[model samples]
Target chain A: MVERWPIVGMGAICSLGSTARETFDALCAGRSGLAPIRGFTTDWYTSDSLFEIDDRDDSKDRPGRATGFLLSVIAEALTDAGLSDDLGDVPVLVGTGLRELRSVELWRGSGAAVTPAELHFGAAVRSRFGAWDTHTFSNACSASLYALSLATDLLSAGEADTVVVAGTDSITESMFGVADRVQSIPPDAVRPFDRERRGTILGEGAAAVVLRREPGTGGSPRGWVRGVEVNCDAHHPTAPEAGSIAGAMRAAHQRAGVTPADIDLVMLHGTGTIANDLGEALAMREVYGEDLARPVCTAMKSMTGHTSGASGLHSLITALQSMDAGRVVPVPTLEKPIDEMSGFRLAREQAVPVDARLAQINAFGFGGINAVTVVEGNR
Target chain B: MSEQLFVTGIGVALPGADHRDAVLDPQVPEPVDPAARIGRKGLRYKDRATQLALVAAYEALRDAGLLSDPDDAKSHVAVDASSVAVIAASNYGNLDSVAATIDTIQQDRSTRLVSPINTPNLSSNVIASEAAIRYGLRGPNLTVCNGSTGGLDALRWAGSLLRAGRAEHVLVVAVEPDNDVVRSFAGTPRALDGAVAMVLGPARDEVDTKRPPQAVLSATQRAATIDDLLPRLGVDLTAVDGWYGPGGAAEHGLIGQVRPIELGHDWGTPSSVLGLLQCVHAAARFAAGATGTLLAVCGDPADGVYCGTLVEAPRQASRALTAAGHDAHR
Candidate 1:
């Protein structure tokens, strides 16, 4: 069996809340962060709705918004983990679909004085935390989970005792515009697994977790990451394949030395798109078959919006918090769920009470990149 | 836990290097035409970096005897397609595509003019995923866009995958295109317009018993500085014949008398592909009959340094030495 890494600390900044605890509480309360886009003018686009974080504190308005978000989240995670601000030789692994693309967009459009080096978080991370090494993964939406997998490998390979895995992304005009153009009609909000779901809305924020080989002085670890498996469909660029995703899920379970019956909760990569929901639902069926209802499924995007690369850690943090509270966060916007998920016990409307122990989080991205991570709660 | 990993094949889509032998030549040649090297059939919508990666990947696969024909879609390797993985490293793989899409949006004030077919390239993993899709490699595919240490990090991950029995063979490709979009961000005097690829597999593989290995990867490590890295290598530096890394290896007082062959100074600034280029050059030197141990290290003081040791395979070493003697006599 693979060695399990402990997640000692976690911090999340999203539309729902500015901290992981706040986000979890808000999720349990079934509060949605979806609102009309206020960062930019969506006059020419079909969708004006997005899950944008309120950055009212102008002091947080760094050159790169995403970098600022990441730094803040990292600080919180470090504080939570009882780590010093100076990381010494510790490595930082950051995952993002578009690293500072929004900053680049601003520079290109308005001729902002942002240098090319600012396009990535390397300089920013080094300057702020004095990390010795930083690795950035741009694996689309599944980026963070991939980073998490690499962090696990680093720990297992004796490369490092502790690794900080972070994922952050702000909505870029190009991505927002593409989403607006692709969706013929704009949906009111992100509705995962809903019968009338149109597509995912772009969200902005960051999430981070501190993983250590041994549980350090950070009280009790939030959860233990058993295994993380990443694979590609190699079939399509945008559309996800059920067989490939199912294969990844099975591989993850095998690596974790567990079976589908052992999983008590599942965090679905339900993007609310027609293809994504169907593809995920099909893969879930292939894995659990008739016993799909045993694992209580939940989709965090319905409340957090699609944070893109950060969604995986967002979902992971939510899962751990739910396990601690003995409740499954609901998809407040999911009403009249899709028929493909008919047999699955998808949490909806109200947080469901359960004795959740082990949870599986799914993060699928464009280019058919899929990452499945199985985590066991310490509670 | 360091298993026996061998460099079975080496390929380069470098400028002025038509064959693997010329990869180490200092003279810069004319720009490489990816269409001529590979094919133009799937060139549309692919950025220059992806195209270069394809050319290098094709050559590496063929060199490793994994592919019978580059044009044949049904060409199969002895191993299952699902058992092969592809790992690519690039800092700005999709910069051009992203710039174009954003430019179109800025000009038209909408994304209606952007081509949907090119949208997938916006994701950085597209470089590695496209290679997997083209070659039908269904195993774990990853693209490392980290800082300068990305290439060595890719190698480390490949080793981890192999040790864990996740993949039988891994195709590692590192590319950097010297285009306007890249130049704008690279801020380097010369950005490398090339791609380096190598096929890494277990030394005890059953399928290729007859083939002589290129070199055996002895160890790989990442540390905050050269001082921290040398002791971790676990290899005797006095017996090491050559070193391929930054210029300050001798100053570190660990490399002994071996003058470091700095790749960045010889070649252009390769950024993320620097570490892989170092390995490629070391492999070439080994293939040319240079004996003993060769070390390839890259990365900066800020991002830490990554180093790997390559040792000559026993059988290949004898053959290479004999060939070198024969060439010397002639």
Candidate 2:
């Protein structure tokens, strides 16, 4: 057997809560982070509703909202991993889908407090995590999922023994403009799997995790990242492909050396948009086939909203928390599940307890990027 | 463990009004001609960076015998691009479109004026995925935004794909388009418009295979200092036939005291790819003999993290991929 890459520590700062525990607890209780947009003001329609982090601190040292959020999670993740102040050889991989636009916004006055003329999203993370080296992935929303996979490859390929995979993005005016032009943002509550769901509610958050090659005994790990698979549909830059999405999911399970039957939980990349919900649900049914012994499925975007690059990591950590609690957190506002998702055992308000050993999280992005990662429970 | 990447094909497009393959000074700003691949008609509305990447990708694919000439039946390889993965490296993406979209937003105070096509180019992954969409590559399409060291980073990720058996060949391409917006705000004075493409495949051990390989590449290795990297590649620091570098980067400590020689032309914006392209061009430099070894090293000025690749031309001795260490770190 090869070296096991167990996630020794996890930290997250999203609209739901400031820490992993708070977010997990809130999500399990069916709480939502969606609210009126804060911080940066925009002239677009998205100003009415966004899952923006509450910017309580006006510190001059904070580079940008996203960078500040990223540092907080990385610090907590390092501390949680027991490495604390000793990050000697560990490489840092960051996936920020909107880093370019975010950097531009930072220069445009919102981040005037940020010092140093040239502030980089990934480089800022390097100093915070004490990483000797870093890698940046900007594959739109599927970025951090690719980062996690790259980290696993780094570990398995013997590049490094441990790695910190983290990602962060902030709702910016430019992105809001893009969304406004496309008219992809919902006017009401962000709802996934709901027949009346309009579109995605853009969100911002940061998540960090330290992965070790061997199972850690010093602290409680969220889960073990078994395998990650990524591919492109080559169909449309914006549209999701059902066949390719199913192919990515099956590939992940196959690489993890497991069958669909072995998966206990499936966290979807449900963006609440009509197209995404339908496409992802159809892909799920294709992967699991017609077997009634299907895995429990849920989508966290109903609460967290679409976290962009951080969505996949958030889903993985959320699944691990539910697995630790021996339950599955229901997808909030999932009334009137889509036709394609009706065949699966979709989670609703109540927490359904199950002996979930393996959990799979799927993330799809623009540019036809599709990523699926399988993680094993700490148990 | 990492495996060696056999270099089967290489293509490069240099900046200037003409967009030549070999440019003495590529610092001039000019978009590459889409030429016959997409033709002028297809790329009329496409951004400069996308057009450059498309052209380079087509050239590399053709050089690797993955694409057949419509007129020549004997040149037909009939290779399926769906099985080939793509890894693209870039620092700024299409800043031109990003600037236009942002400018339109400020000018009109509404996004309605921005073209739908220009908005998506803000994401750098569009540069990589656009090529995948055009070529029908179903494998992993990765985009790295690590500035100067991006080309090496893409090669490292490509090596990992080979080791994992995820793909048989990966088209590693890097393109930097002239963005007046970037020049005005971002202080990259040396930035130029250019695109480089290379095809990496599973390291071949057969010397007399059906196709003669351009070069055999060792797994890309990362080093804080040149001393650490040379030992891993099992080569003495000064033993290589030549070294290719961009400007004074080779002398910059991480690569040790090697002369900062510009092998052919190092005027490209993404200097790392320029260095790799220079190394590939050095294959023809050794006219006295058909055999030589060259080491290409590049360092990101932001951080001194160094990544180097050892290229053996018309080979002789070789070391296993696992023995030669490599890292795709930022």
Candidate 3:
């Protein structure tokens, strides 16, 4: 059987909240963080709505907004894990879609004196936290989950006692422009699985989880990462294929040593786009068939917006908090659910009370990269 | 440590080198177009890095006897399509595409004029995904854009996938293009414009009598420093037949006792392709009938260091040399 890695500490900063606890509470209360783009002028694009954090750190030493978010979340995670900020030899694996691309754009747009060394976060991470080593994965939206998979492998292979897996992305003009052009009319709010959903709004934030070989001395583990499986569709660049996604989900379940019946909750990668929602729904049907209603489903994007690369860990932290509170957060903006997800019991309108334990989180990215993670929450 | 991984095939698309035998050439040659080496039928939308990676992957697969033609849609391989994986490492693979998109947006003040073909190229994983799609490699595909240690980390990830039974064969490719954007990001006047690919798989007992592995990867480890990593491998570096590492290792006093063979000295400072280039050079040395083991160390001080030990395959060293088309005298 595959060994399970314990998630000892987690920290998240997104539109909903600045901390994981605050985000979970906002999610339960069905608060929406989507608003007009404040970080940059979105006058060039028709779609101005985005989930952006309000906290600003304009220090001269700060490389960029994305790096600031990443460092803040990592510090929170380390502190929550009862570890010193000076990570002696722990390997930090970061997943980012567009690392410092926004900073580059800013530099090019307005002669900002951003150094080339700030392009990659290795130097920033080393200087701030004194990390021993760092590696960054840019697997699109599913980047962090891939980092999580690698961290689990490190623990299973006895490579490290603890590994920090983080995902961060700030909305870039390039990506936002692409998203704006792709959709005929960009929607004001993210509405996952809704029939009227036009497209997903871009969001910015960072999320991190600390995985340990054993329970750390700081605190008990939030949950155990039972298994994670990653695969490629090799079909299309932006469009997702259902067959490969279903295969990844099955592989993750097999690795986790769990059956469809044991899962109590599922965090869908519901980007609310016509292609993404329909593809994810088709993949779920292929996995569960008639038993899809067994696990309560929720789409965190409706509240947190599409966090992109950080969405997987954002969903993961939300799932753990749901299990703790015995309530599944609702997809607040989900109304007139799509016909494809008719049989699935999606949490909508209000939070659902349940004794959830085993939960699965799905993160699909551009280039047909897909990652599925199964975690077992502590009761 | 990995469970006896083997290097079965090697391919390169370096500036000065065209074939595996010339990968370690000291003289720099004129720049060659990747589309010229590989066919240009489907190379219109692909960026330079992706094209280079595709060329290298095609050669590597053909070298491994898994593919016959790059244009053939039905080339047969020994393993299943779903059992092969692709892992790529590049720090600036998508720089050109991203810069083009951003520049277009900035110039037009809108995204309506952005080319649809170039939109997907903005994704960093597109290089690896394109390789997988071209070859129908459906297993775990990943792209490493980390700092200096990305190449070695890609190798480590391939080992993990193989040991965990996720893939029967893995095509590990590392490419860095020499473009203005790349050079700007690298903070150098000139940067490495090359790609290297190696097909790695588990070393099975029932090896084909006719074809043998080029080398056996005994172990790979990473640590803050060479001093902290050496004891973990439990191998005597002094006894190894060859040592390949960065030039900075000599200053750190890690390689004072041993003569380190530094590859890519003239290629400029490579970001993530240095480690894979080192491996390709070592494989060529092994195929040329070098004895004992060779160590390839890669990484910078900030990202730490990674060391991988490659031992010559004992029984099939002679046959492997013939299979790789290496001149035994060279």
The parts of candidate 3 lying over 4 Å away from their true place are A57-63, A114-117, A217-219, B1-3, B26-28, B68-78, B204-206, B226-229, B247-254, B262-265, B301-330
Better of 1 and 2 by DockQ: 2
The sequence of per-residue lDDT tens digits that candidate 1 reaches over residues A1-379 is 5689999888999998899999999989999898867766666576777898988454122348899889999999999898889985687989898888777666656656676456667768878887756777778899899889888877876767989999999988777777777777888888899999988898888999999988886488989999999888888778999999999999999889999999999999899999999999999999998679899999989988899989999989888988998999998998899888998998989999989899999999988889999999988
Inter-residue clash pairs, candidate 1? none
lDDT tens string, model 3, B1-330?
A: 334567777788888886677875645666757768876777788888898898888878877767745355334355687789899998878877777777888788888888776877887888999888778888888888776767777887888788667788999999988888777656788777888898887553366755567667654566667666555445565555656665423344345365666564477667788877877777777667766666666766544445444444444442222221111001
Every candidate's chain B TM-score: 0.87, 0.82, 0.87
Winner of 2 and 3 under lDDT: 3
Q: What lDDT score goes with residue B222 in model 1?
A: 58
After best superposition, candidate 1 residue B73: deviation in angstroms? 7.0
Native contacts recovered by model 2: 0.48
Off by over 4 Å in 1: A56-62, A113-117, B26-28, B68-78, B204-209, B247-256, B262-267, B301-330
The true-versus-predicted C-alpha distance at residue A288 of model 1, in Å, is 0.9
RMSD of each: 5.2, 3.8, 4.8
Relative to the true structure, how large is the alpha-carbon lDDT of every model?
0.79, 0.72, 0.79
Best by DockQ: 2
C-alpha lDDT of residue B145 in model 1? 74
Candidate achieving the largest TM-score: 3
| lDDT tens digits, residue span A222-308, model 2 | 678889999988888788899999999888887888888888898889888878888888888888886524789888888888899
